[model samples]
Target: MTTLDSGERRRGSDTRPLITELIDEGTVESIAQEAWISLVGEDEVLVPLPGGPATDPVSSWVDVVGPWTGSVVLTTGRRTAEELTRALLREHSPAVLEEEDVADAFGEIANVVGGNVKAALPGPSGLSLPDVGSAPALRNPADLCRVELQWRGEPVSISVQGALPPLPAPR
Candidate 1:
């Protein structure tokens, strides 16, 4: 009879790499910039300066499951989200934006950004459907790679954070 390890032998040790180890802030910023230009519009640029805290904040995110599992979250104020929706929709935007409109548009943006982020990571990953609401609580701070930027003068932040807490130190 042949016996398989079943990954039990390494259970006490976690060799998984952190987000910081896999991707950097500048790469994330560049990804966002590309997504912005492609989806938001060529004229729309994400300035790499912090625009301060957001009021009436909302967040959209998608989960990535693979060697490094986590969420790619995009957060900004509700008003800014609406503006983003309009920018995304352009002339197709409704005269009065609805909650569903915001959710769909914002979720799509998260999808695009999340997709690009996933591609940059080590592959064989799966992405979850985008969700819009409050951002997920940070689990392992050391596994986070975040970037803050201004879009149309509003504060927007992108956080690529790991979903798991720090593993117990190897004995």
Candidate 2:
């Protein structure tokens, strides 16, 4: 949020929690839960891969925006991600966010989750922006803060990363 002539953060200074909680109540739980379940359901059977090539590993996300470097490391098979996308767009009418739109959706999801998560924290920022992508781990793994969020008992891990240089040394 930029500042006006007075040099104050234009968005506001008070009541971020209220704003985020309202959003969570309105959207996050339902959208995330449905999306997760559609991708990986106990009732649905998928051939277990032997952790080889041709077998698509689960997709994960890393949040690298603002002061909040939180990541959501999700293990979603290619099949699961595709199925989730189709089901989510069809049922929720989110207008079919394309792969090109991953950035947009990533930011949106991060913002939503951050807000809700912030509501739970006493001191919170105004919805950290989100970044998402398919990060394949090579010899050296990515170092990121990991948190698991479960919807109705299904666990999805979220990772939060620090700025490579720690937010410019806090001004």
Candidate 3:
């Protein structure tokens, strides 16, 4: 954020609450579970156990702008993403899934999860359209709320991270 005074731009102090203060790992896990059940299938479950790290990660995210600003990101393996698309699409899934198909389905899941996350946050906040690609880099570790889980034994991670870097230490 920027402060304007006397024709000069000054950096504003970041007083926003850290994501960890506003939310927690359990909350993020619960949110993801609910989204999975509703969108993936009523019986679909997200186990709290952490699986091995993703080999080829693909991420989908929606930017949240408000009293706390950042992106709600979902990251998993490309193969897992394809499997999720097939599961989400079910009978309607193509015999051969296209790249766009995976992106669309994966992005939709992020949208649902991100929307709920935005609502849980101090609002009057705006949610951006879901984007599929690499995950956003962490700006401040202290400002992150992250959860790791398994979906069909595949590793999946959800991160609610701050957009801005940490504030300078008071001198």
Best by TM-score: 1
Highest lDDT scorer: 1
**Per-prediction TM-score to the true structure, in the order listed:** 0.91, 0.39, 0.91
Where is model 1 poorest over a 10-residue stretch in terms of lDDT?
A: 6-15
**What RMSD does each model have against the real structure?**
3.7, 11.5, 5.3
Once superposed on the true structure, which residue ranges of model 3 sit more than 4 Å away at CA? 1-14
Q: After superposition, how far is residue 161 of candidate 2 from its true place, in Å?
A: 4.2
Question: Over 4 Å off in model 2, which ranges?
Answer: 1-69, 72-75, 91-98, 101-111, 126-128, 135-156, 161-171
Q: Measured by C-alpha RMSD in angstroms, how accurate is candidate 2?
A: 11.5
Summarize candidate 2's per-residue lDDT along 17-134 as a digit string, tens digits: 2222223332434444444444434453222222222135344443323333333334444453444445434565355556644444333444554554445434434443454556
Local accuracy of candidate 3 as per-residue lDDT tens digits, 1-171: 875474323334435688987887888889899999988999999999888789899999999999999999999999999999999999999999999999999999999999989998998999999999999999999999988899989999999999999988745
What C-alpha lDDT values do all the predictions have?
0.95, 0.40, 0.91
Better of 2 and 3 by lDDT: 3
Least accurate 10 contiguous residues by lDDT in model 3: 6-15
